[model samples]
Target: MNPAPKSWWGTPRTITETIDNRKISWLELFSDLIYVVIIHTFVENLTEHFNLFGFITFWVLFLFFFNTWTNMVLYFDLHGQNNLRNLFFALLQVVAIAITATFTGEAFAGHYTGFIWAYSFNQLIYMYLYWQTMRNDPLHATTTRPFLIAYVVGEALLIGSIWLPSLPLQQALIIISLLIFVSTVMSEHRNFDREFKQRQIPFELNSAILERYGLFTMIVLGESLAGIIEHMTAEHTHLADYTHFGLALLCIIGTWMIYYTLMDERKIEADRYWPISFFRGIHRFLIACLTLQSFFIGQTLGTGQLVYYRGLSLVTAASLLALLALTRLPRFNVQPLATWPTRWLVLGIIAILILQFAPVFVGLLLMDLILLGIGILNWTKNV
Candidate 1:
């Protein structure tokens, strides 16, 4: 006799399977609004000084804000019942994220212990919700258990480290944060191992996750663009400097064009054959590149730092754009020398380097031309 079909609540679901049910939901996209505020707050903090302690604190707080929201979204996307209660919970989480952003500076200043408390509390609640979801419908218990433990331990160390009240203790907090990051990463590996062994994740679900990550990348890019516009409006009384304004616009457009031409939609769709773990690793790097680039842009605009006119900013942007291109290239098995696109990218970098010592206007002009050239080339090639 054939085995009876399992009930919906009885059969365990893989992470990928869960995501496929609701790919790119409105709720997920809308939830990222809070992060816009958080990024702004980070920029404000960085503008004050390049202090070591302040930078470290900014990184930790930024990561915490990002990771907490990401984990929550991942959990709900996988396990939420799509009911009113869960919806409310998600909304509450957004509010919590905004609150955390508001107090980030104070927390760094060691004045707002309440913000720390609130952050830790929200994390605990998030973890508890995940545990409840697992209890109700346990799937990949080995992966989930380790992940939860890591989450708990990380939060504990984070909260505990805050109370040390000494510089040594503060330094130790940074170390503990690194450990937390390691544990979180290991948990992902554990999840992948279990998924591979069980053969539960599907191609669609993997695509969903990657696409979600890409949307976050868009958020960072948009934030950077907004910062530039805001700075120009507030600082430059003469909006008549159409040349400088046009170059800035070209730079932004070029960055977007180069990145999207290489990967954007294609990368997400290619998740079926690619190892999800490897894809995630590549994504982390991509996000880092985008974040750093955004930071550079914000620093440039906010401070009038002219780093880009010199070669440093241009090289930095080129290196990141090149890395983004290379990630896409690997999947096609295209060797660097054999690829004209890569050659052009390298030439662009070299030009950027040489232009560093030139007049700022000259450097800007060259960058605009290079980006426009790349954009035109990619368009012609139908990339």
Candidate 2:
């Protein structure tokens, strides 16, 4: 088939290859920096409210930002081109996201005005992008329709939200909009399974998409790294603080090792809907828990709160268990948990949970040791 002709404005690149073998462009990497800033702002906010309510708030906000990022990622991965038009819209998104970040710290409070407008504008931009993608890439119109419709409805809700009298109403409006958007995306992806079975569409996973996920995970893990640095740089530290520092460092490093060991760059045939949906669901939880652990680790080190300490241990255990679940995805390259390492992971989870009842420092020490042991086992096995 002949490629779509470029308009005076621009056109999306055609899908010439079954496997999208393109490298992630510099623009894509640059775009991610804005999201990193957003994550940093939210992390700081999480530090202030390090309780159950705070966690819930952070998770909600995280999902909001994450959904925005995911939409852009899919658009760019599937249809984006490194041209003047793409560059123009990409910069516009950055500015909008930066504006959203400014109001994100207090989005549910008095600052909902700026957050709502910024997010609404962001959705409008995406609406245009997706609409144009469908026009320019008629081959995947079915794939693009759901996204465009979701954005349109989401934008309507966001715009209509401005008329609401109270923050509670506005918050409710925003959450409902997100829920609708997610439901639309999920429903469309479910169609992918049927389409794949009938050979109506080619729905294979690509390396570029996998690489993007890995990059996002690395950026999220930086929150924990920042916490480690915060601990190291504090003044008036004692030997116990030093011990806590060592354990925190080991735990963060071990987390990184386990993640990479399991989520290596192995392409999967994401033809069926459920496997891809489950892969995404697990990753969202995994990253959210990892970010939560960063704060819990910091709070445990500084304030020595039993709640924070327990949170640290439990999230760490849950993260590893999540990785174990990822290994079970049939289409994913990683096999089901190896019996030997599976035993260690189970034992580690149990030990880590049990040790939380001990003194903070003692529990942290034992938990870190177990994590490091599991990490070593994973690394050596892969080697």
Candidate 3:
């Protein structure tokens, strides 16, 4: 009798070849479709209402939306294989993500009761997928067990929180989610280390994973731009008649310039230190910067009012500066600048600050100029 065909759901022995051959498959693209829908929902919700409290609520929901999608993608890269069963499960996840996106507006209105339930259910489905994948390969059974258990427990608590409304259940669930995240990371690292010790993995595999993660960062950045465009156009009857529209456009372009100027493709490839972990953490800050920028742009276009927080537009201007400062952290290698690319960032920040105090239109113009200057500088430096 012949043994059953090997299931195509376990981690592949050759990670490099898996990534290079595009064995990560079309799942990433499928996931991006769901993310784009979520971003559209978020921007629509923001335009309908403009208030600090509402913004904060939406911000929290956005983070959860991002975390859920990112975690699932990371797990799939580590464990998923190309096959009919895996394809079916991946499609299910995409559907679940679409359902979760539908709730963003209500979720932002502090009507998290139903949103949380939907999100928790979505998580449960992904968790089941992970469990099924592990069941097909005993080698992964021990490593994935803790993550599976934690996710189930976390989802249970999260679902329970929906019923309590005012009992700080959201906060509790958030904590549990973090715990589950940590456990999952720990389990993967352990498996990776063991594989390395046994000489079963190669450096190229890890590099490919990091590179793929970087591509996801680009997705988030692109989605943020889409949100900015949608919010600006929807709020104004004749968007082309408003100066704010141009400002929003410039800001979006400037953001892309800043990121691309400093994070050139070659630099991304050359980095050798725990590339996946480092990129994952840094991308969170990048997304935060982009999200806040969208909020500020939406506010300006909708209200034509510029309120200052610590001498900058509460959300728009300040968030941009904050994002710049964040990018300067050692992890991003903006400190102790030995390269010309790094020096341009320092100069760009100073220029941006000076523009912040000018008239709104002038400030935006200056921001664009600075971005152009940085791009030119990066080009000259051979970045």
Candidate 4:
């Protein structure tokens, strides 16, 4: 696309866009920094209530957050003009994230009016940005309009839900809103193949998109890394505390190995066979699991909450399984999980889950061992 309009507050010229450069710009990094704050807030909320309903709420809010973020990323990938207008909108996104984070608690408590308005406002800007670009690229804009409609109606319900005195009614409204959001994703993706085939709108993935995805995944895991660093440096002077902290750090390293092993560039063919929705879904789940693990570790190390140790094992094992699914190894180049090492790892995760229900420390020890086994498998594979 030609540079965003030479004037302030104008759309970019998409007609001339080509696949020449694919590096993450400084501005994109700045924007992603803002996104980390949002993700952190979500994690804190999820761990604040470690129950089934809390998990459900986390997933619901996550889908909305993911949708808003994906649209913005796609827009910039396609039509970013990199002018004051784009920067200004990016700043607006930061504010929107802050508002959502601020009202996260109330939203979960059924006082969602402010949160809905904030979310709706964010979606509105996304639509406007597309509208600006759509003047030059109607086909792409048309493909995204369904999502725009869904956001509008969903926000409207969110606003109305505020007046609902009955808790169940408010919950119903939110549920319906979530369903609308789901439909938007499904509808747009369902038509994407047809739209791309018929319209020939120069849609293709470059290495940078994959790089961005990987970078985002790293950012999420960085939270885990940060927690580990903090715990190690804290004043846990007793021998047992020191030992547990060391084991926790090892598990964090193990989590890193699981990702770098299966998701290395050797395994992921970003150019082909990667469906965006699936890719995003797996990454979201991966982030969720890691976030849970980090929270559990922090709680254990901070308050000596040994009870959360089993929960930590569960999410760490869950993350391993989810990452394996994401690697698509069985269907793609690598051999299936039936491989000896991989099979034992799966069995190991199951064993941890069942055994954790035994004496808590027993489960925690086994979890750490399983992680160490994974790291060893990769590190010594050639040896």
Candidate 5:
């Protein structure tokens, strides 16, 4: 095969030069299957400890996995070989993720060993793939130098922390590991502009990458749907169960309506400017919101009377309100749904706060109404 026609080589090789040619490969989609299982496992754990500390811890654990997956996908888009080498690393990532899944339920409790090793392995795979690209393309390596350093050191600290038997010392090590992980990721984004500027060919976000985020959101919605069906199929489900279940599905649909309507590549591309910060923050927030919404989904599925708690109401409301706020980020101004109805969203959030203290019956009814209102707003073009 020829190297291609006047190829300068660098800005993520694509399969075609046609105007409408950006497409995600089957292998990329196939790699996302493990995430469903990973999300499920993490959610199950979140339910186990619904308190503040547990909730915070759950988010932390989730970010670790979320960050790992996000970068892996981005890396593939930049430098996926599409051969046995790619397959081998992708499979390794799955194995690592599966092993990490085994420990997610109790990552901080007692199974840190498995979690650390698996997590490190995942990071290692990213580093190796990156190193390959770095060796072949020196400029690419230079662009990612900080990330490479932070990732390696972070993995080492994570692994070493597993050995310290002292509870306090181990806890400190764990915190350091998290910092390292976060620092590297931040650096990667911070340095992206430098890379883009230096490159003779400017890098642009394609429909395919944005679509990847949209597809992942769909997977999460599927998880919410599963939660709804689980409750609907329960034995001797009461009217409350049926009602709540129905509302849950409707809420998910409402969310779906708002999200799909706004998540358009054309709109995003039409923006006055595009920054890595915008993409980074928007995508991260959206992904986090879906997981939080799943938390609400599990809560809504409580079939028996007296099942819903104030905490559940509060959390569910926060998820919706947070999502609405995220959609309004200035970076997303191109989309129609990005900024309208802020006042209404505020009211919806207020209703959720009220729901936090109100009875489950009252809460679900109010919640669905808010969702319905947003759904209507999103469905039509009117303000």
Candidate 6:
């Protein structure tokens, strides 16, 4: 097979040649910094409101941003080159996201027109990138087609939403567009194995793409740290303040320990299609849960209400569910540990569910202990 055409700009790397050797690019890392800002804005908005409606809106916006990130990461992983054209594309994405961030704080305040338009522009950029990929990389047309159509239609819906008279109607339109895009992504990944096999390409784990996922997760984890810092800087201090701080820190560290351990042994089971999508979908849920955990932690420290306490319990419980779901994926090399981590994670989940009715600190402390136990058990088993 001939290499894809090259220009003054770099040639798109073929999976056949580069999949085994691809490395994350500096430009990709830099673009990810912009997302840190984007996520912080959304998290700040939720912190300010701290209500049911705010929680729902936060996740919706998060899903929208996450969908955009997934598509961009896929494009860069599959076809992106370190060339002038790709740099230009990355800059456009950053600018669009920055503009979107400016409006995100006010998105729920009847000032969402800018956010919608800027986000639509971001999708427009993606549509162009996918169209270019489809033309240049004919071998992956099946994979790129769903993304191209989704971006076109999704952006159209978002652009149309700017004209709606009611805020709820506009929000509904935005959600519809997100649903269309997300469903397309999940559907394509579900068919990933069959599609790649039809093209006579054996599926393998793309380490560069996996690094992108890990990097994004790590960036979002910073939200938890940010909350901890916010709590530490309070003017007045008490023993309870210090206790909440320690629990929150332990929760963050525990989550980090579990995620990276699982990720260290991660593999791609290309024979099955559902697990491919399932893995990505679960990471999405996990990232969202971590952000929610940050919010609940800070609220529990400041307000200390039944609602905030319960929110902390529930969010931490949901994070465990995400972890448990990840363990079930066949991608992990579980034979070495004798399946100890999976069993412990389930016990942790059950314990959290029961303790959620207790104080938030009880659930948080239990989570830290469970995660620590998993780590200790893994270490002993390996020894």
Q: How would you encode candidate 3's per-residue C-alpha lDDT over 283-349 as one tens digit per residue?
A: 6655655555555565555555544211223333443444444344454342323445556665666
Q: Quote each prediction's TM-score.
A: 0.80, 0.90, 0.76, 0.84, 0.84, 0.90
Backbone atom clashes (below 3 Å) for every candidate? 0, 0, 0, 2, 0, 0
lDDT values of the candidates? 0.61, 0.75, 0.58, 0.68, 0.66, 0.74
Q: Order the candidates by lDDT, highest first — what do you get?
A: 2, 6, 4, 5, 1, 3
Model 5 agreement with the true structure over 1-383: per-residue lDDT tens digits: 22223332333333222224447878889888888987777667767876666666676787788777777777766666546667777788888877887888777464577788778877888887777767767777545677788877877888898889786686578778887775564556535655655563334456777788788888888887887687577633467666667777777886777566545443343222244345555566667667767766666566324334454455556655555644565554444343356666677778777776666666666777787787687567533
lDDT of 4 by residue, 119-170 (tens): 8777778778777676667776656666666777887887788788897898
Worst 10 residues of 4 by lDDT: 265-274
**Worst 10 contiguous positions by lDDT, candidate 2:** 13-22
Q: Candidate 1 regions off by >4 Å?
A: 1-22, 51-54, 107-112, 187-191, 202-205, 238-240, 268-275, 298-326, 329-338, 353-355
Better of 2 and 3 by TM-score: 2
Name model 2 segments beyond 4 Å from true. 1-9, 15-20, 108-110, 194-202, 331-334
lDDT of 5 at 329: 53
Off by over 4 Å in 6: 1-8, 14-17, 189-194, 331-338, 379-383
lDDT over C-alpha atoms for residue 273 of model 2: 68
Model 6, C-alpha of 319: deviation from truth (Å): 1.5
